[model samples]
Target: MNPETLLLMGLGAVVIIAAARWIGARTGLPAAALLAVAGIVYAVLPGPNISLDPHIVLTFVLPPLLYSAALESSLLAIRANLRIVIGLSVLLVFATALLVGAGFGLFVAGATFAAGVAVGAAVAPPDPVAALAVGRKVGLPPRLVTIIQGEGLLNDATALTILNVAVAAAVSGHFSLPKAAGLFVLAAAGGTAVGVGVAYLVRLLRPLARDPLLANAISLATPFVAYYIGEQLHVSGVLAVVVAGLIVGHDTPRSGTGASRLQTNAVWRLVDFLLEGIVFLLIGQQLPAVMRGLAKYQTSTVVIAVAVTVGVTLLLRPVWLSLTQAAHLLLRREDEGLNAREIAALSWAGTRGVISLAAVFTLPLTTGAGEPFPDRDLLLFCTFVVVLVTLVGQGLTFAPLVRRLGLRANEVDEARQRNEARMASVHAALERLDDLEEDEPGDAPTIEALRGRMQERLRRYEHRLDVLQSAESDEVPVSEHYESALRIQRLAIEAQREELLRWRDAGNLPDEGLRRLERELDHEERVLPDRRE
Candidate 1:
């Protein structure tokens, strides 16, 4: 495609993404699913289409998306749920791949185990984008959210490693369990080391990253840098991006300036919005490409292949979760195990996505002996079917399933915790004011006024906490005063903004001065808690 054509395509994609997001917001459907559907619609139409380049998607696209998710995820929460995360991301992935591979090899007529395993690895990892998007909107419990996020962040690396091994075995007509195991360990360990080293290196450069522009640049570049280093060292680049994101996110608060942090965050949010939208759309467009090669296969063969891949992908998740929970119970682990409802919810949340399609699309056209890679086209079609079923089928229903399960976050409790933390912070501020008052002799009145403000804030938090404690259910209590106060504050800020605009219009205030004041108000409004909450 020419530059002009590509530019037009990009613009069209943005329009579709915006429309999907708007519709999803109103209908309570997942935007990811809607976008995928839109892409399918586009693909079936007469216009030009883009084929999914797995190499480009894996190298350029996957890193930043994983990193952004990692940055937003809570390190402490993931650590707390380490066992379940591992079970899902690592062990469960392996089991699913093996089971799916076995099913395919035995059932599908000409499919070899290695070729089956190649596709198995592709479909094993659940793309949590659609699930997490809906889960957060529906208010899933914090622990469930953490597990989903952790699994999504880590599972790609495992799946990709498995895929690579399976591909090598199929190509060379040889398979070595010991060598594969060693390779996995090396990848995991090396990826972790590279991630840590990159993160700490960024930490050391914190002084230079204090400028907002510089910080955004460094933050944007970090993921690709880590990915490149890991790949060069023959490690798992996906894991490296994720690990670096987690560490950098953890260190950001202490190492970064407020302005730089704010700017970097906004930049990343935009990056995430565009990249995810493009990726999901790209997935749908692959329909024509994947289907074109499937004409050679018999109808029964196609049916059987699809059934084996889709069936294993869907059915095995719940069974695996139940088995893991049983094992955890038998071992008497200290952590509380998942209940039946949570298990069902998590099982349904196993929606595959772009990564599956991308990984499968990377299959080599021919093996080492110059013969065609056995069942490569069939594998591609099956992988696409898995992605479509899980992505659109499960993504659309995940929210309703969670609702039926009655698995929602405890908003009242969560709000109370946040209020309690606010109270503690206010108390600390008051203590600092006292120290300042003692050290700076002439600032007594200033200190007194600051103390009064903090005292009032503390009192409000205490009252909110009391109301939350006495709530009849998990619903966050409605506070008329709090809502009215928020409205008044917003109005006051709006009025101030209008006055500044008037001043600038009259040539009394410069544009630069108006922007500086406007930014201050914007930050103030940003800090306000959402009224809908």
Candidate 2:
């Protein structure tokens, strides 16, 4: 592409992305899907077609996107659900590939077992970006979100490994189960080791930088380095990027200065936004091409493939979730566990996306005899159909399902926890303030004022907790009077927030002051009953 064409494409992408977001917000569809459709429409036009090289996309775009997703994910949450993550990431991918591939080989005409497995592996992993974006909008339970993200992050490696093996076997006209299994283990272990090692080195070098921006730049380059190193060593690049992201994200605070932390976060956020936009837009652009490919396949074949893929993707999730939950119960007798609501949320949230598309596009174009690969276009078309059906169909219905199931954040439980923590912190602060007041009598007025503010905040917390607890017990009936009081409190908090914003705009308030006040407003808003519900 020429520079002028590239410039136009960049500008068009931005415009399309913005419009997609606006439309999605109004219609409850994912902005990614909308952006993708726009890309497809643009591609079908007569002028200057944009063709993306699979190698450039897999090497350049994917590493950063995966790293960003991994960085934003909470390590603690992943650790908590380690078993579930492992099961979904490794075991589920293998099972899905085996079953789907076997079915295709046995049933579909002109499809070999190797090609079938390759396609299955390509479509096995759900897209983390799509799932999380839609899941948050639908208010999926935090635990479910964690599991989905965890699986999404790790499954890419498994799928990619399987894909490589399948393609190699197809090209070489040979297969070795033991060799493939060994390669999988080696790639995973090697990738993880390299990633963690690179992360530690980055941490060590971070403190040597005087400028925060420079430190942030080092953090940005680490993922690319990890990925390249892993690929050079014949390891799993996906796993390498993911592990590196997690290590740096979790350990950055210890190695980074305050300025470094802020700069790093800002850089990652910008990178995340741009890459996410590009991925979704590419999805839209590929749609026309996919449809054209499907033209060669018989209508009945296309229908059968679409029906089977969508059905398996949707139904497999709920079955896996139920089985996982049962296993968790057997293994651990903990009081806290994922309830049915969470499992339901997980079942509905399995939306396939970019990874599947990228994998399909990366398939080899020729078989062992140097003849053209069979059903290559058909495989890509079927994969796209799976993504569209799951993303648009499930993404749209997710929120309504949540409401029907009465699945929302348990505010009463949250408030009780917050109150307990706040009460303890207040008591500790009060003791410290008492000693300080005695030591500095001249500053007693300031201390007393601070003490009074803290006391008032404590009282508000207690009042909110009491209301929630009482409401939970059904001792206090819903009252118009309480509702009115909540409305008034909301208005007051809104006014206070505006005042804080004004101070921020005028440079009269520090960042900390604005953040603290905003947090207070958020807490108050959360406790306020949802009138809409």
For model 1, where is the 10-residue window of minimal lDDT?
173-182
In the range 1-533, model 2's lDDT, one tens digit per residue, is: 78988999889788877787788889887777676667767778877755545677778888888888888888889999888788889987877776667767777777777777778888888886766777777666677788888998899899989888988876776656677678899999999998888887877886564478788778778778989999999999889999989887787657767656766777888887777878777776786667766767888777766665666667777888788788879989563566788788777777787778888888877876888777888888888888777766776677777778876655456556666787789989989999999999999999999999999867865765666667744223345655787789889999999999999999999989899889778866875755322
Residue 52, model 2, lDDT: 47
Question: Over 4 Å off in model 1, which ranges?
Answer: none
What lDDT, from 0 to 1, does candidate 2 have?
0.78
TM-score of every candidate = 0.98, 0.80
Whole-model Cα lDDT per candidate? 0.92, 0.78
Per-residue lDDT tens digits of candidate 1, residues 76-187?
Answer: 9999999999999988888778877888789999888888888999999999989999999999999999999999999999999988999998888776666766888899
Name the candidate that leads on lDDT. Answer: 1
Candidate 2 regions with alpha-carbon error over 4 angstroms: 206-211, 253-255, 292-296, 326-339, 415-533
Best by TM-score: 1
